[model samples]
Target: MSKFNYVLNFSPDTWTPSMESKAEENCLGGIQNFPFAPSMKIDRLGAVCDFSYTSYSRGRDPKSSQPDNQDFHLVDSRPFPKTKVRYVQRKFQKETAQAYHQKQQQQEKAEMLLRQGKKNAKMRQAGTQQYQYSRHRFVSRMRTLTEWSIEPLSSWISVAEIPLSSLPKQFLDVSKSTIEDIGWFGTLKSYNKSMDRISPKLPMALKDFGNMEFLQPTTSDDEILRDALLQPEKNIDVAITDQILACLVAAAQSKYSWHILVTNVDGKLIFDKQDGSIIDLITVNETSAEPPLPDNVNKNNRPHLLGLEALKSNQNYTQNIQINGDEGIIKQFEPIPFSEEHQDANVESKCYRYRIFSLPPRAGASSSENAQKTVRVAIRTEIDAQIPNAESENSGFIFARALNEYDPKTVKTWNTQLESQKGALLATEIRNNACQLTKWATQALLSSCDILKLGYIVRRTPNDRESHQIISVQSYKTKELSAQMGLKEENAWGIVRALVDLLSEQPEGQYVILRTPVKHVLRVYRIPDEESSELPQDEQSHKE
Candidate 1:
């Protein structure tokens, strides 16, 4: 057997051995041929001693001095030598107590205010209560309109003109123009053919009713405005533009679920409509007492199809008249790139006129420093055709639109009713096509167009859907037409200003002002950057 020399130190004050070393030694002794050496090395290890004890008498023991029975009491005691954990616990308790007391005080104060017949005070207190519990998802309340005194700027200054070169070169005027002579406007034929080409799977019967093609702006208004503002020579800072303003103005009357995308880029608010948004589609009988049925159920009476037909008719009518009219009266702009199919044209009739209007600050904000910063807005308005005599100051331009009747049997004949019961017909139309007429009036007012010409066209026969004949053309002053439609320009402007101010309060980010379905309420939602692309897709799905 091999003997191993081991030095062991057993000093309680200074000596300690790790558990790993102890385990290794134990394993070595068990596996190998090592025997324990019992040597009296007092200096290397430690000295051991034994104690001698003396016995004590039971009568004189320490326990005999105390009482046989003892009483105990529980007492709350503070921790000694305060640590970070104890300090934090005390701070939290103090804050909780303070908050409880403050809430109690506010409740008592609110009750007192309510009992004192101070209505305004109660309202303010209620607002405060709501504010404390409000979350980010809670929509801000719209401002109450106590007075409708909004007015447009004394004069509007022309900003810039977007050319109409891209528009098909054709005369587009309906004044003194008959539909029979024009032969259904060749544009509709091409538009319908393109629709058919895209939807090869659609049934042939569906093609005759015209596919429900909701015409939307090729480029979003937001993108157009952004690009327009980028021009070095055109430096304009506007809180809101016409597209958003128009939506806001007509919000109270809108029945559809539409949303406006608002992006605050570098402190500038850009209002945009999503791609294929239904908001751009001209609605037919949307606000009527007996509105048209859904497109899926009624093929011919579909609002979208009717609106598209009317839109195409108006476009064709305006282009033809402008093309055939005097060349000197036509307003021309720098030509833009045109499609090969529409390259052969006499002149372009469509032109965009940009103007700026200064909106007054909020009512109560007159005393604030921000009152000096009046809200200025820019609008891109369109002109369908110039007045026959452009030199006349009374009427320099006119806005024209056509209202088509698919079946005169359902309603009164336009030719007879328009002359005898014109007022009744107008009233009926107001009830049925409230949204369409409102939009037309809004557009005309935005452009300050002199005249609004409405053409009444009906199909040649009840069975014939393609061929239509114009019965009569009625023209009204823009302001008079707005009044007839019960549109309060002042109130519209007020709504626009209020919405602009409300949106301006939000931080720099993207927000959506969604008109809730089945409710007249508009809710605001913030969109995360990652999910921003999904908004347009969502809108498209809704459209489909």
Candidate 2:
């Protein structure tokens, strides 16, 4: 018998066996008997082990070196157009079948729900019409109810109980005729004419109350309404009262279909109507007990509001403090440090301070005597991480020598001076007021400069949040001017900041072009121009 044994070593080391003579008797004659020593052919397994997948068949073209049927198919098979997986056949159509079933079920459910909704809608409409009719009848009986001397039901009467058969034993009483005089304002012929008359009177009233330019030229009745809703405490002024009445009167007389909304001084008696048929009444009764004080009343309820006494007491008259770029002097403002009872490990705490410069004389002071007199009020500022620009280090706090000297950059000192119940209330007020003033000033500035085009710039902060910036320039010249200013067209935020700084620092009466992502061209106007009287430079700086 003949046998072959082989050993393979993949290692790098090579060792040679010592020279030894084979025993003549033991030596096999198998190799001598074979003519070519078995031809030394490599089998399929051996070829695979060597990583050679090529075929050795000679029947195919010699030039075609492909190994397997796959390679031949790839090289010579007819091309087929690509198709989506859904179009192709699969063993299990689980997803496709499930999607079809879900869609059918959704359509059926939607149809049923829509039918039910239509039925409910019809019922609701019928009920609404019935209620409105009954309400009209009940209101018409107001004259009869008053003549019978029956006490009026509270305004909280449920609509369900408003019967058409007979008037309720009790009905809301009407007060003295305020609406009778409302029509006496003598209706104007056109809305534009009424607006023209009321618009001029609004500013005059504001000025008469020593509030210079408090109301913008385009101040809308809606804005006044919104302010009354949001800042009730701040609305307790003669100017605001007159402004509201004037706006309401003008709107009522206008040709437009404006409905009247009546509410008491306390807003408890509130009602609205379209026809102006009912006269809602507000009155005080001697027999009724005084309204109870609000359960939540506190001394600092409206710390931002300045009553006549407070305003008179803190009446400050000073000159504008030139902005000193000296950090050494500015840093001398050591206001009381901020403190928190429960500080969080994850929350970052940042402190800021704002100085309100050139507060036009208290709302009712004569501007003639105090034309040059200005007052600076400083308040502590805090930025929560939640706001987009809270992390920004640029606090934009302006400083002047004539400002109230009680610690300009300190939160605690300002809180003490303002007699704030909570340290944070005044800060909120300052931010709100600043945003309001900025909105008005921007509109006025754009109008005064006769520029209709403006650009809005925005950028993402480190936290991946966006902040907005306004950039004004001459129309359609952003690209050309951007090149002149050496600004990158893509770096929108940087351009806006640089341009704002440049324009603010420039001398008055000079025009500059600023580029933004917006397409509108804006004419740049500084606050100190002829329109300076409309918005003070100090207020403008605070807004900026």
Candidate 3:
């Protein structure tokens, strides 16, 4: 009945190919009648569709049925509209101009405030008596050392034994021992002409030491921790395996520029040192009033060379002692002979003990509930050798080190100084090798060593670097040595805790903590992902 069986409601916004095909089908009859006409006509909704009076017409003829005055009369009787032009105001331009003015005003206000603040600060400084001195005079003022001094007591401070019943529950509770001896002590042989020839009374000459090779650790602490303890599943808050605790403890007294690499992997803090970092190179007379000059022509007279020789001497002395094959006296994990190719090379002294100590949460950390939870920190410490107790059944562990003397004239005859003025010699060493001794003391305390042994070594011929002899050996209780060095365990632990807390605040990333070249301040820098991937894995893993 209608034009077509289906109703067509075409919309330009919702038009489809199906609608177009259907319209063509309905207009087939019209297209045949008028070949030149369009296939179909589409009109917008609510648009006029009637076409009886819509045709355009030229001037009509007088004979036509239409009125002759049709052209003179209005078609719809509508009046001619008055033409008008309107200009629309653009809002964006006005808004842009207002914004620019506001910005300019704000900048002007900031500058005014800055100038006013500076003026006020100057006025306040002028009013204060402390700021009365001229800038040059204040900067050039002479500084004097404090005259008040406290003499370190030579006697040991005995700690009163506390009854087990009087101890707190927290103090009594001990975590499972995590002491692991990943390496072993090499076979102890007397440093005589050969392994077969051994003597305790005869002091071995340095020249006889001959061609002694120093083995460096093939596996760095960072790699060891990453492979063993810092697995993806493991969650460690703080890791101090790179002997960073010693550095942190002696940070205040540090004079040289040093840097520590810190990596935060999934919120775990790892402290590491770069390959061939200066921290590993043993330093001699670093804290002396007049340290060795870099231009010193004599290689043997240089601080680093002297330190290396002294280290070699200590290692040779300790390893050469006859222990009667008593390797099992102190527990060793995997014992292996010293080899240059060995992954776990027997470094200085051919023995190292790694013990993990748990640190309690720092006091007054935060008021948050998460902060209340105890944060666990694992610190790995190293001990050099064990002193077999002849009188008692218990063996005493000791940290053995050698103090070498190259030129006796520069300081004094060590043999003569050690005999009559032992205290004075120690004082001089305290002034000269402050950092080295501090680190040694800290390491000894951390490893729970019973004694600290200092072997006095001097060149047999003052001019000769190849020949040297041990003059005497000195032993001090670990605590006594620490006290003598003015090191407090609480202070050291506090410094470590502060560093841990600071690192924890940073986002998960690799950071470097470096000492400023001109100042003693340590700064932290975050390493970008692009730069971190460029670092060599081999270099990082096999650092000395």
Candidate 4:
């Protein structure tokens, strides 16, 4: 027992005459050993069986000096002490350690037998090997599943019970996540971690806690284990499996951590966990971002047909959407929105302004004045490549041209189509939608790792005069700042000037990880917050 249990002595009259003497009779008798110690007796099963109690037949009046301090009275001294408990626990743990050792021995023996290679023992060896392999794999999987630092963490039970008898049969494949499924996740995890916290305020007496040292009888722990929980064999379930697989894919594809948007068939972002700094506004499968969809695999989930082999659901939805008005919806690109938190966590501005270039326009009223309209629309950030700009004579400009020049009616119409069936349609239907051509064209300059090989950093050094001029101005900040300073942009001379200025003017003992478009996410973890006016913590005055 983790704590002691005994009847309290209330008022004097509360104790019946017969109960007075009998209080001590059965009170400590149930306790097998009086002062349970390591050398104390234990059953053959290696369990410490002992209990102690101060029984009182009735309550005592608080004001009364003392009626009689005879049979069954509470003592003030701390009854359970270290020497006794440490000994008992040592014995119990010894047995547990022995069992663990034996299992290890058996596993190694099986391994040796496997290596010998005998005809008669072949089948046995094979079985042994499989068992060993499976156990090893299971342990590895659990480590990954829980993200636990210790390999034996799963085995480190708090000894809640001996025989988990109350477990249901249907609960064999049951796992930690399933137990969490019994309620919300994280709740049960914290609850079980609090074992002995329940108390007198608990409206009832509880587990062993007093200094009345004795090994906890296995039964109490058995009760705790049986009543407290079900046997959890694993944590990964179908949904968790999907998430883990997705993480592996994302990790492979991304240079920096990105946020994940989990949605159901409706495509609304439901679960959001951002890794690095990236505030990604979430939208469900290009539809209305609102009430989340219910999770039902069979009926509604329009599984994303990711990476060919995945989600090969040969259902009727694909064929159905092709002939229906939903053809364009099936082919749209679903960009995951990231909602990352950080002052400057590599956030790409969503509203990138694009300038229309039309023959620099004729200088007359006949000319369409707004023809070179600067349309500033919010677009999703490019996950793979920096979309070239026309000014660059490379990618961003060309990409912008295609996007701005697209048929407004088609774009607006298809956008409407996405919103209409936001939740009801299948994922396949959305993919094969009529906009497949538009989607492909947009992503063409992106990571067309499969087609157009047009995305990577290209470095070119400047010529003599250009390099000399830029280097001379070398020092400060943004290109805009350099231009304002009237420095030549011929060869990054302004950039050099900006850097030199920043080095001299910037405060000491500060670090910065600044990045702009065309640069990867820069994670700058400041070692100190110099801007804060708070005095040093160590300088606080201490009361004498």
User: What is the C-alpha local distance difference test score of each model?
Assistant: 0.53, 0.25, 0.56, 0.24
TM-scores across all candidates? 0.54, 0.17, 0.56, 0.16
Give a tens-digit lDDT track for model 2, residues 147-190: 21111223222112112112112121112101110001100110
The number of the candidate with the highest TM-score is: 3
lDDT of 1 by residue, 1-544 (tens): 6555554534455444343345545434544344566443435322222122233345467775456534545676976675757888999999999999999999999998778768666656787666555632243211111111111122322222212221112121223211111001011100011211211122122112132222234324334455545654544344344445666666767665566777766645667766545565556666766565443344655655665566666555444334333333444443322222345643343555556565555444435333435555556665666554456642456677767664466655666676588788888787777666777788887776787767666665565546665556666788998888777765666555555555566566677776655445666666666656554443322421
How does candidate 3 score on lDDT? 0.56
Predicted candidate 4 versus true structure: per-residue lDDT over 4-79, tens digit per residue? 4675434465322333455555555556665664342313212212123232222244533354434557768866
What is the overall TM-score of model 3 with all chains considered together?
A: 0.56
TM-score-superior candidate, 3 or 4: 3
TM-score, cand. 2 vs. native? 0.17
Q: Judging by lDDT against the true structure, name the best candidate.
A: 3
In model 4, how many backbone clashes occur? 59
Judge candidate 1 at residue 356 and give its lDDT: 59
TM-score of 4: 0.16
The order of the candidates by TM-score, greatest first, is 3, 1, 2, 4
* Per-candidate alpha-carbon RMSD to the true structure: 28.2, 28.4, 33.2, 35.9
